[model samples]
Target: MLLITGITGHTGGYFLKELINNKYEGAIRCIVRNTSNTSSIDNSRLNIEKVVGDLDDPEFINRIMVGVHTVMHIYNIHHSPMIVQAAIENKINRAILVHTTGIYSKFKYASEGYKIIEGKISELIKNPKCPTSITILRPTMIYGDLCDRNMSKFIKMVDKLRIMPVINGGRSLIQPVNARDLGVALFTVLMSQKETTGKVYDLSGEKPIKMIDVFKIITKELNLKTIYISVPLSIGVSLARILKILTLGKIDSIERVQRMGEDRSYSHNNATIDFGYNPMSFEKGIKIEVQEYLKKNRN
Candidate 1:
């Protein structure tokens, strides 16, 4: 049996589809919160058991780990310690844990916590007593459908604004992976335990594109008359900070705006070699995203 978590989330939906489309012949159990819409995991075609519980509860995770040989945890990386503990206790064969490349962020407050949590995970892997083979896959900014808030927010903003501000002239490089591509990497790693176990894979996009180019591509795809207004990095951050304060923290992420000037690209060559990980280009990806976004959001 395979136990999965976050199967109802953005990338989770894509991951579930991969398993079903490939006709994975195994008893599957998915851990989810009580309120999660299980429409993606609880359909008639798939025979997946939807086990509702809190992954934060070690007891809950431990209980479900039983009889489950392989575990695919697609949820919060912060909850990984307990999941790792549960996997060790149950003597699981292979555990696939999904993380983000955001761990490399230059943002002070966020990076500190991410590094600390990652440190704990690192300690688990190095510990001699632990036996479960764990593979950590770090995907860059994930965007495919509307469920992806990162790109979706920008898409919505483009629709609302006459002129979109290009921070630092969108010069800093970024490589974002599509949700389906990340899911495929996870499934491939899960199936190929020998090569991927005890390794960290940086699953980025097909190539890195300048941040300015991203908005330009969006404008092209949407066929909108949204003009570009260049905003200096410092000016952009200050405006974001001021808006956040005036909005009582509702317009948060001043740091996100600041970090827009910092490059956030990484190499996925190892992931490509190991599992034939082929990710779609951002140009092609944004085309699909615009279609999905327009269906629900456009007038």
Candidate 2:
């Protein structure tokens, strides 16, 4: 049996669909919270099952791990240790975790949290007491459809304002991977679990582009006239900090602004060498996402 966490999320949803379309022979189980809307994934497949519960609950973890062999954790990285503990207890052999490249960011808080989780996972994987093999994939900014919280927001902003702000001339480099491509990469890793165990790979787009260029590509795709205003990084960070305080952290803060100003590009060569992880170009990915966003909003 195969166990999947966060099956209803963007990347997870794509992973689930790919699995089903490939006619996976094993039974699939999904753990979801009570408030999670499964309407989109409420399929009639006999092999698919949904269990409602919080990941924080030990009882829930115990119940969900029964008869499950391989686990794909696509949700919160914070809950990974708990999941690994439960998987070890249940004698599950292999596990894959979806993490982010933000762990390597210059921002202290962002890097610290991911670093803690990554360290915990590494420690557990190395422990002889736990024999479950682990594979960790750290992907760069993921953007696709309306569900994405990253570039989709920028697309909407450009569509509305027709003018966007560029911090430090938006020179900071970013390699945004498509969610579907990420799903494929995860599947590839799962199929080659033995070779990928106890390894970490950085997944990214085909190439890195300047932040300002990303905005220009979006505007060009939409055939919209948008002007970019270059703002000093220091001033932008200060304004974001003030807004963050005023909005009670609802808006971008100092750390977020700092991360935006730092380069986030990474080479996916290791992933490719390990599992043939070839992702599409950002231009093509953004074009597909923009089309989806337009179609979704048109309804």
Candidate 3:
């Protein structure tokens, strides 16, 4: 049996599609929140079961972990420790956690949170009482289709404003991985469980591109004449802070502005060497996303 979480999310939704396309015959179970919409995933022909509950509940976690041989957790990192504990109790053979590459960011709060979660997973794995092999995959900024928050938001902003801000000349290098490619990477790692057990891999795009170029690609795809204005990092951060306060924390924060100025490129060599992880180029992925965004908005 295969157990999965975050099936309603972007990457998780794509992962479920990949499994259904490949005609996976295993008894698949998905844990989702009551408010999550499962319309995107086609569970018609598959032997699938849905467990609607909260991750914080121990009884709910234990109930879904029953008879699950492999657990693919793609939800929030905060609930990872609880899920890992439940998996261990259920004697699951393997657990694949989909974490973020933001853990490597210069931002203190983001990095520390991921580090703590990673630490908890490590501690559980080392426990002699628990023998479930764990594989952690840290993906770069994941963007694909209209469901994503990264490039899709950029497209929307450029479409409306026609003038987008570029901090520090937008030279910060970023490797934005497509959600479909991430789904493929997750499936590949699961199939190569024997070699990937107790491993951590960084899943990134085919190559790194400047943030300005990313915005350019989006503009080109949308056929929108958007002007990119370069701003000093310090100035942008300060303005973001003020806007955040004025908006009552509804707007972007200083930390996010700082992150925009920092390079977030990561190497996918380890994932490639282990499971043949080859993602599409940024331009191609962004084009697909732009089209999806336009189509949805047009409807």
Candidate 4:
């Protein structure tokens, strides 16, 4: 049986779909806190057993991991090392950890923003009780269904402002991987237990697109007559800082704007080679996202 946590989330939902699509002959159990909410899947092969408990609860881990072969951990909350550690303690042989790429390059940013995600991962990996072979997949900006935030916000902002701002020298790059592709990569990793144990895969899109160009595409898709204005990074940072202070730094929107002005490009050659990861093109991903947005907002 395959046990999945955070089944309501983007990658988790997609992973469930991928599993069903592949016709895996196994019981799929979703450990969800809210048993009242049923998944949108209509497949007989999918059996969701909602284990009602929080990740912070110690006793819930053992109860959920019982008789589970593989555990796909996709918790939205960053901390809570106990969740994974408990799985390890329960002797789940194969575990797949879904981490964000933000954890590597800027460790400080990752640690502060992510809050013990990578640290917890390392802790679980080194623990003696952790006999479970683990595969870590860190992805960059993800876009597609179940994504009500991030890129969708950009599109909404453009639709609202009727004009988009592109930071000066908007050549900073981004690789927004489609959610389905990420799901596919996760299933591929789980299905194959070869040389991936104790390794990390950077699952990114096929190509990186300029941040400004991304806004342009979003604007065009919304059929909005918008003008792109380039703002200096210094000014943008100051504004972001002020807004952050104003918002008390709770999910600051300005911080996201500041990041767009900075370059964030990397090679996913390792993931491609290791897991046969084939992420969809950024263009196609954006197109699908746009369609989904339009459909959601349609009258």
Candidate 5:
């Protein structure tokens, strides 16, 4: 049996579709939050057992690990240590874990817990007694659907306000992979377990675009006339500091603002050479996404 976590989520939903397309015959089990909506999986034709629980609970994880040979933990990267521990303890031989490209962030606050978790997972993998072979797939900013919270929010803001506040002259580079493309890459890695085992792949979009170009594309796709206001990086960080205090640390985005000046692009040549990974260009993917958003808003 194959165990999956977060199959009801955005990327997970697409990954499940890929599995269905490939005609995977394995018995699948998914761990969903108590409040999770499983209508998509429950209504699907795949043989899936829905296990209600939290990844935070080792007891629940251990219980679900039974009869499971492969694990796909896609819910959260912070929850990886426990999942990897459980995979090691349960003697599961093969697993695919989704982490993030934020692990490479230069900002301390942003990369906090990332290195520690990656290190812990690495140590677990190094254990001579460990039986699990783990593969880590890191994806850059994921933007496809409306719920993505990255590009869609930008689109909505551009539509509503017609003004975009960009920091650092909006020159920093970002590569955002479409959820559908990332899903296909996930399935490719799953099928090539022998080649992908113990390897890390960066599943990024086709290419990197400047932060300003991102907003430009959004304005064009949404057919909105927008004004771009460029704020200096220092000023942006100061505003974030004030917002952080005003929100009682709830909106603490000082590091996020600071990191905006840094480039976030990565090469995915390895993923391409290994898994035949081919991703759609941002304009093509975002056009379809924008159309969906426009249609829904019209309805």
Candidate 6:
């Protein structure tokens, strides 16, 4: 049996669909906190099962890990493995952890002082009897139709305002991988030979695109004429700090601006060489994603 966490999100949904489409005959279990809407989910693969429970609950971990041979950890949270300590104790092997690139790229404390998040996952992987033959996948700027958080928000904001926001001329490089491709990569890692254990793969697009060029893609996709306005990082950070204070860290326009300042360019050579993983071109993904958005919003 294979267990998938965060089965409702973009990467998880794509992984589920791909696994089902591939006619994977193994028992597939998804861990979700909410069970109120299981009617619409595809059950073509009768081996699929839904294990309901909160990610933080140890009982949920216990329920899903029973007789499970492999686990794909995509549920993003602070200290997620702590919840699944029972699985480690049970000695269930072949765990693939899907972590964020933020822990690698956007982490301020990593270079300056100590390795906090990634370091902890590494420590867990080192445990001899932990039953976690871990493969850590850190992906950069995952963008797709169901992706409403980062790049999608920028597209939506631009579409709504008929203007694009640029931070200091938007020269920072970005490597935005499609969510579907990310899903495929995860599935690949999960299903690969046991030799892939203890490997760290940095998944990224074929090439990095400039932040300004990303705005151009959104403009062309939406067929909207918009001018880019440059805002300094200092100004953006100051405003975001104020908004965080005013909205109690809920309003996030300022944080987006801060993230736009990072250089997210990454090399895909290691990922390709290790697991034969190659992400689709950004140009190709943009068209498909735009169509999906149009289809969803039209109804």
For all the candidates, what are their Cα RMSDs to the real structure? 1.5, 1.6, 1.6, 2.6, 1.2, 2.7
- What is the lDDT for 247 in model 5? 94
Question: Which pairs clash (backbone N, Cα, C closer than 3 Å) in model 3?
Answer: none
Encode model 2's per-residue lDDT on 1-299: one tens digit a residue. 88999988999877877776776778889888889888756773537888988988888888899999999999888989888888888899988999889899877788889899888877777778786888888989998777898999899888888667889988999999999898888888988976798899999999999999999999988889988999999998899889988999887667778778899999999898888889988999999999997787766
lDDT of 1 by residue, 27-72 (tens): 8999888789887676737668879888777788889998999989
Best by TM-score: 5
Residue-wise C-alpha lDDT for candidate 4, range 189-275, written one tens digit per residue: 888778688788888889888887888888778788877778888788788888889888874655566576666766789887886
Which parts of model 5 have CA positions greater than 4 angstroms off?
Answer: none
* Candidate 5 lDDT tens digits, 1-299: 99999898999999999988887888999988878888888777888999888788899899999999999989999889899898889999888999999989998877877889999899888977779999999999998999797889877887888667899789999999999998899888988998788899998999999999988898899888899999999999999999999999899788878989999999999999888999999999899889999999967
Q: Which residue window of length 10 is worst by lDDT in model 1?
A: 39-48
Question: What local distance difference test score does each model get?
Answer: 0.86, 0.87, 0.87, 0.74, 0.90, 0.74
Deviation (Å) of 86 in candidate 2: 1.2
Best by lDDT: 5
Locate the minimum summed-lDDT window of 10 residues in model 3: 38-47
Cα TM-score per model:
0.95, 0.95, 0.95, 0.89, 0.97, 0.89
Clashing pairs in 6: none
Scored by lDDT, model 5 comes in at: 0.90
lDDT tens readout by residue for model 3, 26-102: 88898877788876654447888887898989899998988999999998778888889999988999899999899
After superposing all C-alphas onto the true structure, candidate 5 shows an RMSD in angstroms of: 1.2
Model 1 misplacement above 4 A:
none
* Candidate with the larger lDDT of 1 and 2: 2
Model 2: lDDT equals 0.87
Q: Cα RMSD for candidate 1?
A: 1.5
Backbone clashes under 3 angstroms, per model: 1, 0, 0, 0, 0, 0
